[model samples]
Target: MDRKGFSRRQFLQMMASSTAAAIAASAMPLTTLAQDSMSYNEAPMLADLVASGNLPPVQERIPANPRVVTPPEEIGQYGGTLRRAFKGISDRWGPTKLNEEMAIEWDIPDPDTVNVVANYISEWVQNDDATEFTFTLREGLKWSDGHPFTTVDVQFWYDWYYMGDLADRPTPITIAGEPMELEVVDELSWTVRFPAPNPLLPLAIAKLTLGSWAGPTMAAPAHYLSQYIPDLTTDQSLIDAAMEENGVDTWQQLFGDGGTPQGQIAGWWFNPDLPVINAWKSVNHPSNDPWLAERNPYYHAVDPEGNQLPYIDGMTHAWFDDNAVFDLWIAQGEIDAHIRHVASANFTFYKENEAAGDYTVLLWRAAETQAFYPNISHKDPVLREIFNDARFREALSISINRQELNDLVYEGLFEPRQASPVSGSPNYDPEFETRWTEYDPDRANALLDEMGLELVDGVRMRPDGEPLSFTILFQSALAQRGDEVNLVESYWEALGLQVNQELVERTLYQERTDNGDVDVGVWSADRNSVVMADVSRYTAEQADGPWAPLYGAWWANSPRAQEEPPADHPIREIWRLWEATLVEPDEATRNALFKEMLDIHKEHPYMIGTVGEGPVPFIKKNNVGNILGGNIWDDTLRSPGGVASVTWFFRS
Candidate 1:
C-alpha cells in the first residue's frame, strides 16, 4: 500500500524518525534556556489576575520542568475562545478528547507511526523483564487549584479507588490475573510492578488511561478528593453532611454518582470547583446550554518562547440534541476546530460551503466508518447455531453490496472492504480486507440451501420452521448510521431473509447488545490502525461488540455473562492469542501474535465490514492555527488529543 506516493515501509521509516524527533522535543524543558535565566510570559487574562493579586506569577504557577510544545506553524497569539458544539451532558468525549491529559499519550508525529510520549508524567524507566516500571512526576507540577501534584495522589487512587470498592480493576494494569502493585517511591515518583511481563503497559496507558477521571492508578487530586473519602477526612460528619446535601443515602453514591456535585467534581467535567491538570478546566457544568472551559493558569506546558500553553483563552461547546443542528452549526462556521462527529455524507456540503463557513474542509483517514456484526451468541438457539456457522457468516458477508452503500451513504469517499486492519497498519493484508466481500445473491442463496434451510414464501426458513429474521440494532445518535443500516437492510432483504432495522437511543443500544438481545449490531470499526491495542471488534473479549456478547462477557468476567464458551470454540483461540499478546515482551513476536488473531477474523466474518478507510471531514475555522489535517481518526490514538490541541491558537 502507498501513502502520498510512498510505499508502506518507506512511510513507516519516515514516520519513525519524525515521531522520535517530536517525542524528543516534547520531553524538552519549557524554555530553551535554564528556567531561572528565562522570563516566562502569561496569557493576558492570567496577567490581569496576577495584577489584582488574585493569582500567582506565571513562573510560580508553571512547573519547574514544564513540558514544551513546538507549534506546527508559528507561535500563536493568545485569547480567543474556541467555539464548538456537543450533543449534551452525555457528550463527555467531545470535551474529554480535547483535553485528555494522560500520564502518557500516543503521539503520531507522522501519519503512519504511533509513539508513546510522556504527558502528565515526566519520564519513566522500565525493567529489562518489563514487569516493573518506575514513573517520575515533574518536580513542581501543580493541580489547577494550585495544589502540589504528587505520589500521594497516586497512592490515594490506588488504595481507595483501585484496591477499595469504588471501581473495578482496569484491564491495562492487570497481568497474570492480578492487578499490578503500585509502590510510592517518593513525593514525585512511583513504581508499578506486574506479576508477568507487561511491555505493552505504556501503550495501554496511552490508549485507555486518559486522566484521573479515567479511574485508579492514573492518579486523582488527593488533596481535594480526600475531603470526600470518609476514612481520609478527620470529621465523619463532613461525609454525612455532604451525602445529605447531595440527597444520597450512601457515601458511595455521593462520591460516585455523576448527578451529585461531589461525583461531578471527581469527573472534572461537570464541576468548576474540580482541580484538573488539563490545559483547560471546566468553568460551568455540561448541563448548561453552552458548556465553557477556561484555560488553566497552572497548565504545565509552554511554547518554545516560554508562553504558557493553550494559546486560546477558553472553549465553548454549545449543546445540541440533533445531528442536523450540529451540521448546521458547522455549515454556519460556529465550530472553530472539530473532527469528532463530522459526517462523511456531509463532505460535499462542507466543501461547497467552505467559503461561506469561513472554515477549511480537511479529509482525514478513518479506519472503518461502518461495520456489521451478526450475533453468534443470540438468545435463540437456532439462530445462534446459524450465525455460528462460518458459511452462514460468509453468505452474510458476500451478499452485501458494499460499493453501492459506499456510493449512496458515504458519497463514494470510503473503500469497500471487509472488517480488518486499515492499510496503514503494520498487520494490514489485502486478503484480510477483501475476504468474502463480493456482492453475490446467488452464492448467499446456495449457502443457505446447502445448510438445508430452504427458501419459503420469499423468506429463508429455519430448521424449526421459523422465518430467518434478525433486527439490526444501532445507536440512533450516531452520524450516518441510519442511512448505512437502511442500505444494509435492503441488501440482506434481497437475500430472501427478513431484516429489521432498529435505531434505538445510544444507551439502550449498548444495553441490548451487552445483554445479547440483539440479533445484529452495527458500529464503526474504530481502533483499526492499531488493532492489537483494542480487539473488541475481532474477538469476544469486550461486551460492547455485537458478534458474541455473552462470550465476550464471559471472557471479561462480567456479571452479565449468561454462559461461557465450550473448550472447542473458535473464540477460545482468539482469547488465548489476546492473552499471549499482553505478556509478550518482544515487539515483533507480539505483532506476529496479533496478526495470527487477525487471520482468524479473515476466516470467520465475525464483524462484517461494508465501507472503511474513509475520509473524515475535519472542519477548522480559517483563523485556527496548529490544526493538522489528514491525521488518522481512531479512538485509541484519540484523534484531537494526538493532534495536540493544547498548542492550537487563534491567529488574531
Candidate 2:
C-alpha cells in the first residue's frame, strides 16, 4: 500500500489500474504529460497592478528562495475564474481562499502517506538524539501585505499563543507530558528543544494531512498582531484602547474569522489588510454571498521555468442550501470540480451524468469505506459498564452482518472491516482490521447470555431486568446513513438486543456528544493519517465522543478532570503506548508501540467495525488542466489541494 518507491506518475497509474472497485465503478485515467517549460514571470493582473503603482514588482514580491514547482504538463497561462461552492455557514466557514499547505512537500497521489520534504524551511539541523531541532528559514519572505516574515514571528506565537491561553490547542509533540522549550538564534533561525527525543517534530511543522499541530501557515506575523497583544506593548493603555476601539469580546475573535485582520479581508479570496503568505488571498466574507478570492501579488512560489505559481487569477465559491440544490448544479455543469458531498451512493449518479456535464469521473481510493461508526460511551453507568467489557465489545462487533450493510450502503464496493489503517498505510496491520469483524449471531447471543442477559420475546433483558435498548445519535450529513443505522438496528434486534437510532442536527449532535448526552453515536472513525497525526482517536483521545467519553474528558481537561482515571483503567495501556510512541526515537520501537496500540484496540475495540477502504469520486471539468493527478485525497486533511494544487492550471 505504501508506494513510496514508485515515481509520482507511476503511483497514480497504479492506483487507477489496481482497484476492482473502480473498474466496475467507472472512472477515467489521468493524463500528466509534461508541458514545455518556461522561466518565472508574474501574472498579467499583478503586472498591471504594478504599472498602476498598486503593487510591488515581481522580484520584490518573491521569497529569498522561492519554492520551485516543475510544470506537470505544458506551461499554463494565468487567467481564469475557478468556480467553487459551499453548503452552509459554520465554524471557520467559507471556501478555501489559499490552498491548505505550509512550507513543505505533499503526497497528493497517495493521501495516507506523511509524504513530504520541505517548503518554508531551507535547512534543518537536528541533534544526534533529536532533542534539539533547529531550522534555517528562507530570507526576504514577505506576507501578502508585504510584511517581512522572520523568526521573531515564531517566538511571538510561542510567547502569546502557545505558552499563554489564546488557544488551548494540545502539543502532541510533548514527551511524558513535558512541554518542549523554545529558543531563537537569529531572525532567520529558531530551535525547539524537547525534554526527550521527538522524531515527529519535523513531521509536525510540515504535516498538513492531520495530527500533531498541522496547518499551512506555521508562524503568525507579529508585525500585524502585536498591536493587540497586552504584553507586547509597554503601554497598557494602548491594549485597552485597541480593545475598546475594536468593540470585540476577545483578541482571537477580534483577530477575526482567522488570524487575518477584517479590514485587510479581501473579497472571497481574503481581506486586503490581512497579510498572508499564500499564493491567493481571501478579499471578502463568504457568508450571505458568493465568496471570491484573488491572487496574492507577493506569492513566494514559482514554476521551474520561473513563472509565478497559481496560474489562475481568481476563484469564486457559490453556496447552495443542501445536497439537492448542489446536485442540480453539478448535473448542469455549473460546478467545475467538486467532491464534498459525493459519496459511494452518488458514484453512479456522477458517472451517468459526467458526459452531459463535460467532466470526467475519477474513482480514487478512500481511506474510509464505512463512514458510519457506533460509539459505546454512555452517560448511564450500568450501560457504560456493559459496553466497557472487551468480550461484550467483541461479541457486539461480530453480531452485525457487515457484508449486507456494505452492499446496501456502499454497493458492496468496500471491504467489510472496522476502523483501523487500510492496506496502503505504513501503520496498517491486517490483524487489527479483521479481528472481531465476522457476523455471528450465535456467538453474539451466547456472549450476551454469558453477561446474564436473559432473552424475553427476542429481546435481551439487562442485569437490571430492563430490555436491552439504546440509541445511536446521528447527524444528517452522512448520505443514506439512516438506512445504514436501520440495518445495524436490525442486526442487533436479531441478536436479542434493542438498538434505536436518533437523528440530530450537526450543532446539536456536537453539543450533546460534548456534554456526554448520547448513549451510542454513529460517526466516521479516523483515517490512518489521523491516527499518526493525532493519536487521540483510537486511544479515546478526544473528550466528547461516546468512545470512553470519561477517559477522553479526563485526559483532555488535565487538572480540571471531573474524575481521575483509576490506576487500573483498562484503556490506559493504549495511552501509555501512545506516550512511548511519542518519545521513542527508534523506528522499530515506535512501530512496536503503535502495533501494541492496534492490538489492544482489537482486544478491546472502542467502536464497532463495519465497512472501509472504498473508492472516492473526483470530477474534473474538461476546461481544467494540469491536475497532475486526479487524486481523491482525504477532504478532511485538505489532500491533493494542499499537496499538488500549485501545479494545476486552466488549459489555454
Candidate 3:
C-alpha cells in the first residue's frame, strides 16, 4: 500500500484513506481529479482543483447517483400524528455513552430503526461511498421563534459536539480530526466535508455527536446549546478548584453545577418550556400533568399536493414509572401504541400482565449483546495465567451451555448467540460461530484437568497453589431476574471453580464497571456495527475519563505471534484487515472483510457474546400502521414533546 505512489483511481479504490482529496491536490494531475474513485492520486488532484481558482467550482449540481428509496405508501401522508410517552429524559447525549444509545434508537436512521428524523432531513453525504453528500434544508425550517434552520445549526453541532475527542463523534464526524468545512451552498442548502473517506458517515451524521456509546435517545438542539459553549469551554480553573475544595470531587459536580431548571433538558429539547419538537410544538398541558403537541407551520417537509404533514391531532404522555406505562395502556387504553416500550427490574408484573393482554407486552428480545468479561487485570498470577491460557478459555467456552442459558435466562424468548458483536447483523461472520460445549461434565472436568486445575477442600486451585476463588459482581437489579447470579454461581461451582457473587446497586455497579474492579462482569456492548475502528476506539489501551478503550487491555498482550515481532500478532493483523473494510467503497470488498472479521473474532474469543434480539414495541389497533420493524423509540417521538400518536395519521 504505497499510498503516495498510487494514481487517483488506485488511491480511491484502495483499502483505506489512500485517495484523500487534500493529499492529492498537493501533488497529482489536475486532469485526473474526480477519476471515478478516491485513490491516492485522485486525492491530490482533487486538492489541486480546490487549491486552484476552480476550488468550490460553480455548478448547479444534482445527484448523479441512483435515487433514494421513496417512503412507503403507508409512511408518506398528512394529517396524522403520533403521541408517545416516556419515563424520563435520557442522560448523556455525547458519543460512546448512554445518550448515544438513545439517539441511535430514536434520533438517527440506519439499516435498523425504521422511523427516524434524519431520513427526512436531506443529508450532505447521502450515499454509501460518501464521495459526495449534500443537504437541502426544509423550505421554512425554523426554531419556535421563527429563526431559520440553516447550515449554521449543523455547523454548530459539528463544532461543539463532533470536533474533539474521538469518543465525541461516534458515527459521523468521520475524519478523526477537527471539522473542516460548513459551506452554505445556498440559504436552504449546505455542504460539509470530511478530511478523509468515510462511507459509513451518513449514518453517523444522523446520530447525536456526543456520548454515542449509550445508543440513540435524543439530540441537542444546536440553537440553544451553543449559548453555553463559550462559558463552558472558558477557563474556569478557579471555579473548578473551588468546587474541589468544597468537596465536589466528581467531574459531574463541576460540569453539572447549578445552571437552570431546564439545564438537564438542553440535550434533548431546545427550550423545554416552549415545547418545540421537530415537526410540531406543544400547545397545552394540565398543571403537573401530561403535555400535548400540535402541528408546527415551521415543519419543512410537504406533501406532493403542498399540504404540510401531521394530519391527525395532537397526543399525550402520562409520565410515570415503567409499570404505569403498561398499566395505562391496558386500563384506560391511553397508549394508542407503545412507540417505545419501557422496562424495569420488575419482571413479575410483566409476566403476570402479559398473559392478561395488558397492553400487549411485545416481549421481543433485547437488541443488545450481553457477554461475560474476563478481565486480564486479575492480580493473582496463577489465576491470571490460567485465564490467559487458551485451553482454559476453550474449557470455559465449552463448559457453559448456551442452549440452557437461552432457556433459563431468556425464558426461551431469545436465540443463542456466539459472536462477540451483533450475532445476526450483516457484519456477523457465520464461520466464527463458537459452539457451546455440550452439557458434558466429563469434558469440562477433563479440560480443567488437562490444564492442571485441581479441586482441593471443595475449592478449585491452580497448580501453583493459588485459589480459584474470584468475585463476580453484577448489577443487582438484573441479578434479581431469574436469579441470574445464583444460576451462574451454581454452574461454575459444578465446574470446581469457586465463584463468589456480589450484587450491587446500579450506581456502584457502574463505578465498578468503569474501574474494572470485578474479575468478571456481565454487560452488553450494543453498537450499530462492530467495525474494528469502532471497537478499536473503544478498546484502546489508555483511554481517559468516562469512556474505556473499546478493547480490554488483556487481549492485546498475547504471546502468540505469526509475525516476526510478537507485537505483530496475527490477530492484530486480522483486525487491521477487518478495519480496512469500514472505509472500502466497494460493497463486495466490504462484505468480504466483514465475513473475515466475523470468522476471526469467532476463532479468537476476543470477547464471548451470548445472543441477539429486537427491541420490541407494542402498539394498539388504531395505530396499526405506526410501527416500523427496526425503529427504536426516541424521546422526541414520545407524548407531549413530538408528533405524538398523531404522527401515525401521516400514513401514505
Candidate 4:
C-alpha cells in the first residue's frame, strides 16, 4: 500500500502556512485581536443570571477571541436538556468522551485527514526540530467557576501534582525516558522543552486517553486545589481537620478524597464542585438517578453569530444497570442523543421503532468489534511457551470463522478482517487485514498436531501429559464481548481444546490482566485509525491494552513490573523503532519507521483481530439540532466530542 496522508510533520508545517489561515478564518481566533466591535449573544438562562448580577455579561464571560463553531445544520435554539444514558459509575469514559476539553484537539476536516488545532489554548508554536512547544492560553479564558485559567494552572499541574506526590500517573510527553521541562513564558503562555525531538507531542496531546482534562497531565485549578495541599496552604490545622474528616492518616490521602482535586477532577461526574473548562459543568453527582450538567456560562467557544455555546441549556444522564433496559429506553424516545452502549444487536428493533419513537438512528463506523489477545507472558510457563510460538498464534487466528461470527453476532453488518488499521488510514495494508483470518479447522488441527499435541478421547493433551486448557477473561460491561467469546469458545472446543470463559467486572478484569494471570484477554480494537498516537496494542509500551501487560509495565519503567522481556526480545526492537519514530522530523522517514514496527506485528500475530469497520448506532431525538451523522466511532477521535457536541441544541 502506498502512503497517502500527511504525516505529523507535514500537518504541523501545513498548520504553519495554509491551515493556519483556514483556522484563523474559521475556529482559531487570535487572542491578541480584539472582539469589541462584535456584539455577543447569550442563552436566556445565562442572560437572566447576568441581569440578576450573578454572572458576567456574555462579552465579559467569553474570551477576547472566542473559538467559532459553525453549526452542521443551522443555528440551534437553547432551552432543552440533552438526555442520555450511562451504565454505572465505572463507565467514566462514557461522559468523558462527550465532554472532555483539552489544550489541543484533533480536527478531522475529512475522513482521510486529521489535523491538530488549539482548543483550550489560543495558539501554539513548535520549534524547528520539534524539541520545544510554546502554548499561549486564550486571553480572558476562565474555568467553570469563573476563575481565570492561566499558566499558573499549568505550572501547578506539572510541578505540584505530576512531578510531586502524584508521580504514579504517567507523564504525557517523554523523550529518552526523561520528562519534559516546563518554562513559564508569561501569565498567558508557557513552553515545554524536551531533551530530544518529540514530533508526536501534538498528537499525544490530542489523544483522548492521554491528554484530555481527565487524563494524566490534567490542568489543575490552582486556586481551588491549593486549599487541600498542606505545602500550599498556610493553615496546618485545616489540613489536619480535612485528613481527620476524610478518615485518612496522611495529607496525600486526604487531598485525593472524593471532594478534593485529584479524585473529583479525574472523576468529574461524581463531584459537581470540580472546576472544568468543558462546555458543561456537572451540577449533580452521578449517584443521582439522572445526573445533570448545566452549561458553563464562561465557556470559551461561540457560534459563528457570536452566540455563546453550548446551544443546549443543560445535559441529563440517566443511569441503567442493564443494556436491555437502556436499549428499551432508546426505543421509547427517552434519550435525546447518545453514541456509546447502543447495541448493534438491537439495530432492527431500534429501526422498527424509530418513526414511532420520533427519533433517528444513525450508524457510525467502529474500528473493530473485538480483538483477542493470547497471553504470551502468562504466568504458567508451559502455556506461555505454547502461546509464544508463532504457529500456535496463527492456528488460533485461522480457526475462528470471522464471517460466521459477523453474521450471527452483528447481523452480517460488520466487515470480517484481521486486526489492522482502518481501511483508509495511511498505514493500512490489505494483506495485513486479511492474513490468517480464514475458518480452516483442518489446518488448525494440523498445526496443533505439528506442535506434538495429541488428541485423546476428543480432548487435546499438552506436552506435559495434561489436558490443554485455557480461560478467556473478559469484562461483563459490554454484552457483545460475551457473545463474541462464547462463539470463539465453541470453535476452539470443536478443535478438541478445553476452553472456559469467565466474565468479570471491569475493575477485577484490569487487576487480573495487570497481574499477568489471564490466559486470554478480550477487548475491542479501538485507536485503530490513528495507530501512531497509541501503539500500546502493537508494542508493549503501556498496560492500557491486554497484550503483554507485564512487558508493558517494564517498558513504562513502572515499579509494578513483575517480569521483563529478555535483551533479544522482538518487542525491544519495536520499542527502539517507536522511539526513533518519535524523534525523526521528516514525515516520510517517520512513516517508514512506523511501517517497520507494524511489519513486526504482521509477522507475529500478537493480537488476533476479528471483524472491524462495523456500524455503531447513534440515537438522536428529532428535536436535537446540530448533530452530525456518519462520523468514525473510535476512542482516538472521542466520538461525539470529535463531532463537537457543544453546538448541539433542541429546536424550539
Candidate 5:
C-alpha cells in the first residue's frame, strides 16, 4: 500500500492499546466483570474501524493560483519565406530536428527566438499566480490529408501517440525518468495539473508555447495512424512485419537510438511523395541541390494582418560538408541561407569576405560552450579520492587560464565564465560569481598541498598513499584545437599532475558519456526551460537507469555531496513543496516557493558553466532577415532568443 494507507494502520493500533488500558483501570462488580471481559474482546475490533477510514488527513498548504491565459496581442503576424541549410542529421524529418523546424514554422504561438518555442495554448497570470489557461486550436488547422483539425486531433495525439494504451502496440513508455501522463478534460480544453503549485508555470508555459520543451509533435491524423494501431494489436506479427519492411529492429531505433547513422527512414518526409503537416511543406528534393517548401494552404494560424500565414511562398535548403565551401556559398549568393555557422575559428574568412563586400556575417556568442567536469562514477577508488578533494577541483579550475585560452585559442571571440549549468539567464547569481583562478603555479601548488597531494618521483600522490593521475577522454575530431590541448597538457604538467588526453571518435565519445565510462571530460549543456520542470527532472536520482545532466559535484543531495543528505532531505522537501504548490491557492506563497527552488539550484553548482553563446545563422544577402540569433541557452526550444520564422520575408 501507499504511505497514507500504512500510516492509518499504525494509528489504529495505538488507539486500540489506549482503550484497553482504560477499560482495565475501571474497576467493576463481579457480574459487571463478565460484561467487561466480553467488551475487552470486542475492543480490539473497534480499533480496526479506526484503521479503515477514521484517520486524520495529511495536511498541506495548497497554491492559490489558477490556470493562466495569454493575451491575443502577444501573437505576431507578417509574411516572409526563410531559406535554411540542412545539417548532417540522420533523418531530416525525424521527431528531433524536423519537429523543431516544423514547430518554428507554425505550431507554436508567440516565440522568443533566442531561447524557446511557444505552443498554440495561451495562459494568463496575475503576478505569480495563474488565474486561467485557455487553449484555442489553430482555427483552420487541418491534417496533410485535408481532414479538419478539432479537439479530436488533440485527444488522438495524447491517447495514441503519447499514452498508447488504446492499442496493444508496444511503445516507448518511459523517457528521462517518468512515464508521460495524459488526461483529457474535454474537447478543445485540457489542463496539466502540475504535481504541485509552480510559480514559474507562466514562464514555463510561455517557453512551451515557443516549442522549447515540446516540438510541433504534429497532431497525428488519427485517421491514418488509427488504421495501423488496431492492426498491430489484432495481429501479433504485424509489428514484426512492419519492422522488417523498414529494415529496423525496433521503432525507437528509427530515430537514431542515441547514435548517428548515414540514413534512416523515420518520418513522412522520408517519402518524397508523402504529405507533411509543416508550415512550409516539402515540394522537391535533390541530393546535390537545395530542397524546397511551399506554404500549406490549410495552415492553422491567421496572421495579424488577417491573412493566412507563411508569408513566404517557399524555401530552399542547401547542404554543405565543408565550412569554407559554405562561406563561399554565402559570399557568392549561391545558397539562400546558411542556417548554421561552422567556421567561427576562421573569423578571418568572415571578416575579410564581409569587408570585401560579399555579405554580412552575424557573429553570435553561443551561450552553452566548453567546460571540464570530473566523472565521479569512475571505478577507481584512487582517482575518486583525488577528485573528492574540493581543493583539487579549485586548483584545476585555476590551472586553466580561461581568459588566455579564449584569446590565444579562440582569437578573442569567446567569454570566460565559472562553470555552471544556468549561467546565461537571470537565474545566474552575480554573488555566486567567484574570481577566475589566477594562472599562478604557486597557488595551484598551495591548493594541492592543502588537499594532501604531494609530488613523488615526478608524480602527484595523495597523502593517503594514493596516486594522483587521471585520463581525460576527449573528442578526436577536435583537430582544430590540437594546440589548445597541448597547452592544457603543459599547464597541468607543471604541477606534476599527469593528465592524459585520449582522443576518440565522436560516436565513441558520445557513447562513453552516455554509458558513464569517462573519467574527466569537457561537454556543453544547452539552455533549457524549467517552467515544466522537465529540464530539471532527470537531474536527481531516478528510480531506474542513467544519471541526469545535473549529476555532478554541485547537486547537494547527490551521493558525492560533502554532507550526505538524510533520508527525507532537500530533494524530498522540494517534492513536498512542489506538491503543495499544486494545491496552494495563494500567489505569494507559490512565488516564494519557486524562488526557494531557484535559490537551491543556485547554491548547487550542478554543471560547471562556461560561456553564453548564440546559435548564429548565416543568411544569404537576399534572405537578410532570415537569420535567427541569440545567446545559446542550455534549452534550445525555450531560449531560441529570436523571432519565430513567422516574421521572415524574402527581399526582392
Candidate 6:
C-alpha cells in the first residue's frame, strides 16, 4: 500500500540510524534569553512558590515579548474557570484549539486583500515564482513540557509523518494534484518547495496556524515522538510495549492518535506526556462530562503589561445531545457564555431570558449559517443522476423566491443572495447572486420537461418513469431551519417535483454524506470564510467526498470506484482554474481566476441556493470582556476567526 519505497520494517531500520543522528540535532535549550523582556507574575494557585523563591520567575516561563493581547479593560486577573459545552465528542477539541496555534497565516483584513503578515515565524522569504519559501521560527521557544522545539521537529513532521508515515490519510497532494518537498534550513528555520508555483502556500500555513492540528508550522517534537515511531525506535518490541501500555491496536494508531496519551500533536492537547505552546492545556483529556484543562505556564502570549495571556486559569466543558432544548437551557440561566452553536431563531427567547440569566445577545450578520443550499451531488444513484444535471439545479434555484423564504423563516431579515462570495471577497461577483434566482415555476417546469423529467399526474417523472422525488437529508442540529427546509420543499413540489424532507442526528447525517448515501443534501456556507481552505467544494474534483462523492472518489483515486469526467466536463474547467488560481504568482491574476470560477458557478447553477446573508447570534455573559467589538463578521474576523477566548476577562 505504501508506494514510498519503505515498508514498516525498512523504514524502522533506516530510522534507527537516522534517529540516532537526529536525537542530538533535535535537543533545543529552554533557558534562552528571548523571554527576558517580559515582567513576571504567577497565577494565584502558584503565588506562594514565587513568594518563597521556590520556582523560576514568570519571565523565564513566558516567551520574550510574548504575543501581546489588549483586553477590553486593561489586563485581567489570572484565575477563573471558563465553562462551555457541545453536543459531541468530536467537537470537544474545539475549545482547546481556539487562538492557541497562531502562526503562518496571512492577515486578510477582508477576503479581498493579498497582503500576508508573519506571526509565529520570525521571518519568511519567498522566491519570485512563489514556488520556494524559507522561514525562521521564533528563537528560544520551548514546548509546555520544557522541550526545545526546533526546525528538526518540523522536518520530521513534514518529511516523515505527513508525506511518509500516513499511507492512507490525504494531504495537500490531494488538493494541488502535485507533490511537495520540505527541507530544514537550520535549528530555527525551514523551507517548503512545491513542484509548481503555489501562491496558496501562505494560505495553507495560515489555516494551519489558526487551527489546532498537525501542520508544518506546528510539528510534533521529534525527540518526544520517536519512541512511538517504529522506524525511529528501531524496535518492533517497543510497539507492542506501547500497545500494552496505551491499549491501542498498532504503532500508527498510538502515534497518530494525537488526542490520547500517546500523541502530542498540538498545543491544545497539552499533556504531561505531551508538550504545547498555547495559553492552556487539557487537565482531563478524553473527558465526556465537565472536560477540564488548565493554563499553560510557558504561554507564548501576554497582556500589554507583560502578564502571560489566558487571563482565566482554566475551562470546564459540558456535553449535550439535543439542540432542541438549547433555548430551554439558556432560559434556565445555567449557561455562562454561548455564541458558537446557538441559532438566531432563539434570540427572541434568549432576549426574554437575558435579564434573568445575566447575559447579553450580540447579533452579527452571519454569512454562512442563514441559507438552504442543496448539494447537487446527492448520493442515491437515481437522485445523483438527476441532481448532477445542471438543468435540475437551475430549476431548483429559480423556483425558490429567496425573499419569501427569508420573510417566512427569518422575518425577512436575511439577504436574498446566492451561495457565492460575499461583499469583501476579491472573487465576489454580483451576477452570482442574481443569476437564475427569480421565482419562476413555469420556467422550472419547462426546464424539467426539457431535461426529459416529464410531468406524470402532477409529479415529475424520471426517464425510467419512476417518480422524480427524493427526501432532502438534514441534520437535527439545524432544527431551527426546519421551517426553511419545509418551505423550499414546497417550492420544488409546486414545480411538479415531489420533494420531501428527512431529519436525522448530526453524526448520522454527516456519516451518510461522507458515504454518499443520502438523496438531496441540505447545507449552507459563509463562502468567504471557507474559500481558501475548502475551495475544492466549489469545483467537481474534491478531496472531501461528501459534497460530490463520485467525483471526489474519482479525484481521490482514479483507479478505484465508478467513473471520471471526460476532458470536456462542465466542471473540469473549474478544476483547471483552481489549479491555476492557487499557482498563479501575481495577485491580480489569481483574483481574476477566482472571479472566473465564481462566474462558472453562476453560469452553471451546480448548487441550489436560497437566502444568503443573515444575522447569526452571539450571546455571552455581560461581564465577559474583549469581545472584539466591530461591524465585520467574516470568517477570520468574528468568533469564526477571533476565538482567542484566551484574551477575554470578566469585567468585574
lDDT of each: 0.76, 0.62, 0.42, 0.74, 0.43, 0.60
**Largest lDDT belongs to which candidate?**
1
Each prediction's number of clashing residue pairs? 0, 42, 65, 0, 73, 6
TM-scores, each model vs. reference: 0.92, 0.85, 0.62, 0.91, 0.65, 0.85
User: If both were scored by TM-score, which would come out higher, candidate 1 or candidate 4?
Assistant: 1
Residues 97-196 of candidate 5: C-alpha lDDT, one tens digit per residue: 3223222221122222222223332221232333233344433345444565455665665564444533211111122223334445554454433323
* Candidate 4, residue 620: lDDT: 89
> Could you give the candidate ranking by lDDT, starting with the highest?
1, 4, 2, 6, 5, 3
At residue 633, what lDDT does model 6 achieve? 45
Residue-level lDDT tens digits of model 4 in 1-652: 1111224333324323322222223234333335785888999999999999999888888888887766667887878888887865666678777777777776654333345677767887888888988888889999888999888888887776557765434434767878778898999998888888877776677774332245323467788767778778898887687667557777766445322334543346655877778888788877687888888899989877888889888888888877888888888899899888887767888888898889988766665547888887778889988888888888889999999998898787777888877665556777888888988999999999999889999999989999999998887666656778889899889889999988877767777887787898888877766677666667754453567878877777655545888798788898889888888988789989999998888887688888877777889899887776555677766666656678888877
Residue-level error in angstroms, candidate 3, position 480:
6.2
State the local distance difference test value for candidate 1: 0.76
Better by TM-score, candidate 5 or 4: 4
Error of 6 at 463 (Å): 0.7
State the weakest 10-residue window (summed lDDT) of model 4. 18-27
Off by over 4 Å in 3: 1-120, 123-132, 164-184, 206-223, 231-265, 269-358, 361-370, 377-386, 408-411, 420-424, 462-464, 476-481, 525-575, 611-625, 628-646, 649-652
Superposition error at 81 for model 2 (Å): 2.5
Q: Give a tens-digit lDDT track for model 6, residues 266-324.
A: 22443335666656666765444767777766666665666667788777677776775
**lDDT tens string, model 3, 1-652?**
1111223232113212211211111111111112123211112322355468553311111111101222223443444334445433321111012112221112212222222333223433344455455665434445544455555655554554445211133333444433445566776566656565556543343233222112111123455544344444464564456446546653333223221112222322322333233444544422223545555433333322222334444445545444454555654545555533333233344435543443444322233445555654444456556755656666655666667776666554444565343333335444454444345566867888888788787777878787787776656334434354566567778888888877666557655654545566665434423233244422323221111212233333311111121364444555466446656777678767766755654565644455434333344433344333332222212211112222345333
- Comparing 2 and 3 on TM-score, the stronger one: 2
